[model samples]
Target: MKQSKKIAFVAGVASLALLATGCSSSSTAATGAEGSDATLTFMSTEPKSITPQKEPGSQIGMALCANLMEVNSQSQKLEPLAAKSVTSQDAKVWDIELQDGWTFHDGTPVTAHSFAEAWNATATGSNAWQGNGTFVSFKGYEELNPTDGSKASTEKLSGVEVVDETRLRVTLNAPNADFPKLLSTNPTCPMPESAFEDLDAYEQSPVSNGPYKFISWDHNQQVVLEKWDGFKGAEGFSGGADKLVGKIYTAVDAAYTDMTAGNLDMIRNVPATMVDKAKNQLGEQALYEVETASKQQTLQIPEYVEELKSPALRRAISLSIDREAIAASLLKGHAQTSDSLVPPSLGSYVSGSCADCVFDPERAKKILAEDGGFDGTLIIESNSASDQQLVQALTKQIQDNLGIKVQLKPTLGTELSERRNSQKLDGAVFGLWGWSYMSPDQYLSQYETGGDGNTVTGYSNDKVDKLLRAARAEMDEAKAAKLYTEAEAIIVEDLPAIPLFIPTDYGLQSQCAQLNDVQGDLQYYRAGYGC
Candidate 1:
């Protein structure tokens, strides 16, 4: 269940090895109390990589590095972190001023140059960082990853104007109203020159500027990070523990066991089925429901499938699946049946609610009958056993409601992604792999004509494309939100993608160690502050 760069969005489909073993009752874990030197042991599903700019979105990377802006998990608001201030009169041009007296774990002064170098390297084709999608907004992004098969001509981005040691200017390719929110994400966190000097070594123990500094990483075992005494961030003043030690767990059930028994300080991603059980057994105070960035389970209906091309048939299929039933029965109320592609937790939430999204077996059957009844077997593939189980439940509902023959195929997570990317599947594909950012632009752009998340499904609409482009270029937040909402309404009606539910993080935290759920990411540092 190790986290991978590509597999992060596999939707909560982890193998929960539920062995009939008694829980261990150990109470010798360290608490995040002020003036108490403690090491918080966290049970983590291992990250695929810890390299900055390469796998910066990984949980390990987020825990170690401090970005220009820090997003409040609850509010989804961007606050200044490394940058003292970020100002923009025109959305395309932004001036970023770094906070004075901030230093990496290795004692290197964090400068504007550090960010420039890290981003430029990631954008370059030779680096092949999977996170390069984060930097596409940069002015010279296309030059770094040229479509013409030419080598990158520059080391520094033309849009980034270095003002001084503590200041720089960023020029986006187009006006993006949510540019500040983009900078707040972990992938945009600055990396010291030391990381670029020896990429492999940095991955092992990256010099960090956050509340915690990387100490050591034992692959597939544990990653150790100690509190930096010289840390000057706002989170540093808050009551954070002395150290963070992430112990890798192969299964969520085992991690949950350890956490409940007090052997581990915290365990993330408790299985959905176990939510009620954990809450009852461990007490509500011990159970945490963390709001993660909007990860909606969706069915990507490929355009290649002729039978699925019928709007009425697709609508029938969508209505046939009982999302609320699955959310309550299978998910144990851990998720909500989603109406819009954009989760309501975000800023640009659009209420795309419709009668079409409502489950009506009789209406669905009538619709299918009108569209020349779906007689062929509909095959759906998923990565994990849990997801397969969920799909099986949905397929059963489909068969009973719409009288459509359905098949559920289970594949390895990586294999599923490969098949999805290659467009090898003749049927529909389902996954949690969508936008990590809170922007409506990121959400809607997935279905844009030949966009990054669009190529697999070949789902496109001219109206949707026009609206997305306008939103992308709009400097006003209200105008962009309106445009995105208009586009979402069109897509929701067409039924190119069927939204099932929005994913929420359910976990357990010991009384000794606080669990801070920041924008869906569980953090021990925020627990220290009791925010």
Candidate 2:
């Protein structure tokens, strides 16, 4: 759910490349008054799809549709948004009751059927929606999306049943206490009947029920939204901006320049090269930076690499890199050195879950020698321009510390993703994972054998697989977290991927607007505007 270095990966499936989330304003009108008309603009890359279920993590989708559940920005707790309540007795069967009077932008009523139909369409294998993996636990998901790549036997999930216009019942394949957390995702948002009538047309101008409504989409340029005055949710238009405009820019530097010139209102990602200068240039009030809960930078090593399969060799490579130095000097303190696979934002995270993650060149060299030293060059691949510096720094550290020739290969994000999907990535790949919700399961589930996120690394441990499964089914919140923590211990021991850093989410605001804390999805929502 978290945006990758240059793209968003939904349940480990790579989607379109997206810019970091931030909003800017083109209008200079002082419009913070109760009903004053003002436009707030934001930086974004062109979205592949605006449909909520099709591209759940899209900034456009997040703005246009209200999800069943949303994370409280301050508390970081999952709470109801569109849905009045999500209740279950056994955690396997859930009943969702929608808040009455919620309507789509097109004036159509949002009902239980709206959610069921949208979910069914997303689950259908023939549709090939990237968000399909989110519904794997729903009963009949296998029939809808067969792993063998054959035609699906069913189009709808048998577990999702509309009890009435306002209520829906869902039965999962297993008891999952974290099921409610999943609802907070954009994919779970309800769709209007008009969307199903002609999906392609709907994608172009989606009829959503959120704080904003679709206005126009200038492809490769911008997508515009007007505040939906009929929004029934408790949170709506806090910024007082009448229009939310997402201006697509291929370069972050350009956006930052525009922001500095006062032409743009806000920007979520300050170019890595300009991170240090941003505070001095914009002042402390205008610059916002916080440790993100959903992001973790890592280096993934495929198990199929015979010469590097040894856990000791992998551990040595991890130890060789100086994460603290890179985060402080190279990244300008924009990132935190990570010791565990899970970020500290999650309650399940243990401070020192990854013992091998520490930097110890001597120990690394000793381990490499004991495990039969690696022969030949260690190639680390990355596609993102933002990650190039970090990747290069890592290669240098590995070479200097471990005494192995290291190469940093820069490829296009799309090409790198293809190689990852095909499991053809050779030595090591620099990547990052972002989560849509605040849950430890999002981080740990990727290592499960034959799991959605396991396609790239091909690292599988029977104990880890079992632990993840149990964690998914465990009803007790603390128990589920413990299981995930235990699994992380084994995963670090295996060293399929080395946790490197937890980067901070950065934003710059103009004097005209106020920015809220970055949401779990790593997007900055407007809290207020019109200074």
Task: Give the alpha-carbon lDDT of every model.
Answer: 0.70, 0.76
Query: Residue 238 deviation, candidate 2, in Å?
Result: 5.8
* C-alpha positional error of residue 223 in candidate 2 after TM-score superposition, expressed in Å: 1.9
Per-residue accuracy of model 2 over 407-503 as CA lDDT, tens digit each: 8888765467668766788878898787877678887777876565676788889999888878877766788889998999989988888999887
Instruction: For candidate 1, write residues 161-259 as lDDT tens digits.
Output: 888898889998777667777776666777888877788877777776776778888877898877677866543212255677888765556777777
Candidate 1 stretches greater than 4 Å from native: 1-37, 72-77, 148-156, 236-239, 291-295, 301-313, 346-355, 361-389, 399-429, 433-438, 449-462, 472-476, 493-496, 503-505, 519-521, 529-531
Which stretches of model 2 miss by more than 4 angstroms? Answer: 1-36, 74-76, 236-239, 269-273, 291-294, 302-310, 369-372, 375-377, 383-385, 411-427, 450-452, 518-522
Best by TM-score: 2
